[model samples]
Target: MTDENGWDMSASAWVIAQGENGDFTRQFVLDPVIDAWLAGRSFASALDVGCGEGRFCRRLKARHGIVAVTGIDPTEPLLATARAKDPAGDYRLASAENLPFEDHRFDLTVSYLTLIDIPDIERAIAEMARVTAPGGTLLIANLNPFITASGGTAWVKDDSGAKRFVKVDRYLQEHSDWQAWRGIRILNHHRPLSRYMTLLLAAGLRLTRFDEPPAIGGPTEARAAYNRVPYAHVMEWTKA
Candidate 1:
């Protein structure tokens, strides 16, 4: 691996996993909620933190009509892939804890499924807030705290090989765990929901909306499994 996070080494696998459509949670669960949140909204400039392969950055322009979109990631391989895919797009190699743009540069700043990947959650949240213009929104999509707290032991199955119930422990504890699947290995951090809320509020962001969205489309089995536990959530915070 080229980096400690393993994302540099797993970049290709990550891209493959997110093929034309995103993985199950993104396509069926998170996308619908994000679409609804962005309905009738328009932005002149947007920043996507931890934008692997620039998928959401493209979605901002192609689907939502955002004029200028800049994506940043710490992994160079992913940024290279994103740049190759969208030559005209701005994909920078940068970390969320230290954004390279001027203060209050973007009207819409987003962190989609990325908070878990950041080692310094407080610093990352502060940097994200710093770059967001006044009256702008910071949209976040993330795995639920319960789900992350499970730390890869998310389900307990019976002898019949059926899921009995989700398993969550140490809900209030903050930690990191290694996740390996589909040729991708990476570290994911887990923090209590209150940790995230406290950081956002401390950054002077007002919570505008929050939702534990249900899956709208995917394989029947996967959709059913997701709805049972609702593994992800979305939040919208605004800078007043």
Candidate 2:
């Protein structure tokens, strides 16, 4: 499963499952924070690392007026879908650990829900920082360390079989977890919150923004549950 073939096999199903924007959590919670971060901060060039299907890249152009937005991923099947969806855009088959671009190539770079899937996140962060121009921004949206460290999204069932409370455990150890949905299966690695922040600092990126935004415009019951503890975390950093 470490190889890219699994994603190729799951490509069609992944596209179908994601629809035009993204999954339930992404659309309802994460996107708003990401959108707010990008708001009024247009860049000349932007890069999306591990950009599955290039949805955000297209948004960068249409919404933020970024003149050039390039998306790169190790999975060819996902890149194919991105190219098919946006014929005029630049989509490359590449890995975040080894970006195919010169240093300081982009004014802004993003890794949306992608870092958890990468095995060598330190290397990827180094490359991301390398490609971002000095004073440039690098934004990352991820499953909250608290959520992923718990292994999976789970809830405790009471006598009546209702979800009484969410379960969160293993916050101190780093590990991997598997997820499957609609014929799409993938592996995700988890690390504590301190590790992620430490990596960004070690990569010479300064943290500017951190947030755990609540789900917005979704089912009331679900939103109420998420309001207790958000499942997503967004971080904004600047190359210094």
Candidate 3:
């Protein structure tokens, strides 16, 4: 989880500017994560891993009335931002491969667009399934690999941005069904669609639902860039 690349994960410039300039991208989260969770049913406690600034976690609390919520991430700076928003919910500095919690402690576990960044995705997912209480939901989300493979045009504009994008694509291209994701230097495990499904099944999770949120969760131009590939996708399953 140590991002040696020194990517500016320090409260994503997007998130920071939103906070400072009062233009957070939080609203976009509603269409996919919160709304999707509520559509299923209310759960007692939930945990969000890779919880950038805990923005979505806080929204889940406020929007769905989930009483117990926690957010964990390896990024200390981001965790600090999450803490500032909701001091009540537990916030931990941790990695997905080895969470700092007891087995089966949470009713639901989720990560937002984070799996692609994880170096050890299978282990991380195994941990996710391992920590979920039986019958509890485990949600995995990422940008569609097909989008990247099909030349979905969501590239970052500078060297800093290109590095982040390349690091992710390098690992993901291995499982790329979409064709365009096959370049070398891909450091991420951005599995293709089938891999996502296969891993969930292998982890003993019963498939429940999948979501491909509309146009980057909204049609706005700024967000549209990310959505250029196909906004968001969620794979839901219950531990069995």
Candidate 4:
């Protein structure tokens, strides 16, 4: 019924297909975020925003049995794939800016490498805190837009399976809002971790810790690879 609707469907399908073989996207930067998650003491319920194809959902489900993991995304095919892969997983096809749940419905909110791709990140962050009960944690693994390594954009590989890549500057353009295109294109807003901290704090959250994942992929053949991890930031905060 809207522009985002179709785009969401396409985005979801693209991710589902990407994960059909293996979780290509999540693998790119799972370590830094997972470490933060494992550090959490507990949670009664969890919500994952921009939950692309349930990569983080599966991990959450396995870590916390029947923890009432709810994944919300605007992509239909991605939700379907997530639903099919984890039959018991709960999902809602909705935009990140507007979630379809009552306030304080979740004990925790987890988003991985999702903030940068989202056009309305401020609204999304607000919605995340809204769904989280006070004192609950919000763990986000947003793009350090300034990371020198590389984004998870796909690349070609060598005959020997060595990984190589290109920056893929125009990757998120079609998916972003025209007004926000400048920021996304140039990664101007998503710069240093301090910026994210300011945004999170403005949303009425308290910053906890930050982590950057180490790059440990290849050095043998040199070919197209995926999600070159130059650097990333892992954030932990509480809804205050």
Candidate 5:
């Protein structure tokens, strides 16, 4: 099945996996960095591109006091769940490649761990830049390119079943791989880090901050494992 279909099929499981606190990476790694960057800043409106289940949208409002938060995703089942959870929230059925909104409409735009799911990343990044108001921020959290390039077989474990190192190949190649775990199956696209950097820079966005954050808190073992090979990075950009 197509990745889109897979998301539709696994919507329930996905929602369950991301309970109230979110998964380990989100709870410990991404959220802290996001919150720190957003601290003391207020925006009237925000857009969460590929916002599954409206998690970050709610976070923006509840934590940051953002008044108008909109979330868009291609998966209807996910949108349905989002709307069900936040009945008054503006959750739209849309894809990142073609956002259903006016140009420069949002004060702050976000793409949290969703870039890998986008097939036409160039168009999607352009669309994201187009909809972001001048001076508005485009914050993104994504899996590290090395982790994606590893194709889910990143760890090389020793005889004692301890990870020795990460195995990565074809780092310059762009491809897709099927990933299945915890009752969810999906296809994620992999691109060289240079590809993402070049595209974002060409989109007329200026990079304000970049980070490969380590886990701040979680299970001792899990956090230590993640810190050994940090799998995610965050980039904050602004449209000029």
Candidate 6:
């Protein structure tokens, strides 16, 4: 279900479903890509915007050698879970649209799979860019516009109950949709790829790397099919 602020209040379900690594897509596809991509970069401080359970924030300290990592989310339940897990962790209740920080406050700022949940994406992107230090990186992982164009992850099936293909409609139109999985109910917004790129460019950030990672090891047929279609886009941008 949703909260007063329109955020999904399914923190427990999300943590249980994702565990430490994340859901299937994040565990197999997104994490590997992000880890490898981050291996070549260096940052002493990091901020995870919309960090649900602060998993990435903890990982940034343990795996990526970032001594200081801060996580922020609007959902109280999620922040509670994050704090319970790491009492010493810096997990704050905040919105991506208005980060509580000064200009260029972080060496690395990240938005991991949370942009779709944000209604004011342009403002959030600007905030992310604002918090990132000059020459530092603003890494973002988001649902691919093409995939969200289908409205949801629902795919059309064939006569034998076999998945045919992902259906996409009104791709060029920007709108919001509802998604329910397990006990989680959330709102997701869809916009064309150009909209995101233009906003980032307008914010004075340069796109350095971009990739559309595919499902690696999931249900065989689904994996194969998803490989052909981009599911998510991971990008690394530097503030100029």
Q: Enumerate residue pairs that collide in model 6.
A: none
| Cα-lDDT of candidate 2 | 0.87
Error of model 4, residue 81, in angstroms:
0.9
Query: Tens digit of lDDT per residue, candidate 3, span 64-91?
Result: 7888888888778778877887778788
Q: Model 3: which residue pairs collide? A: 149-180, 170-185, 170-186, 170-187, 171-186, 171-187, 171-188
Model 5 Cα lDDT, one tens digit per residue, 20-65: 8799999999999999999999898999999999898889989999
Tell me the TM-score of each prediction against the true structure: 0.98, 0.94, 0.74, 0.70, 0.97, 0.94
Give Cα-based local distance difference scores for all models.
0.94, 0.87, 0.67, 0.64, 0.94, 0.87
State the weakest 10-residue window (summed lDDT) of model 5.
1-10
Ranking by TM-score: 1, 5, 6, 2, 3, 4
Candidate 1 residue pairs in backbone clash = none
For candidate 5, report its TM-score.
0.97
Q: Compared with the true structure, what per-residue lDDT tens digits does model 2 show for residues 120-146?
A: 988999999999999999999988877
Q: Residues 1-240, candidate 4: write the lDDT tens digits.
A: 455424443554456445543333345445535644566466678888978688677777675553788998776767887898888889888877999999988878888767765667678788888888998889887655543222334344679865554444443232332222211222222334555567789888998877666543433222122234344567789887
- Residue range 1-240, candidate 1, lDDT tens digits: 458888988999999999866899989999988998998998989999999998999899888999799999999999998898889999998999999999999999999999999999999999999999999999999999998998988999999989999988999999999999999999999999999999999999999999999998889999899889998999999998
Score candidate 6 by lDDT. 0.87
Model 6: CA > 4 A from native: 1-8, 218-222
Indicate whether candidate 2 or candidate 6 has the larger lDDT: 2
| Candidate with better lDDT, 4 vs 6 | 6
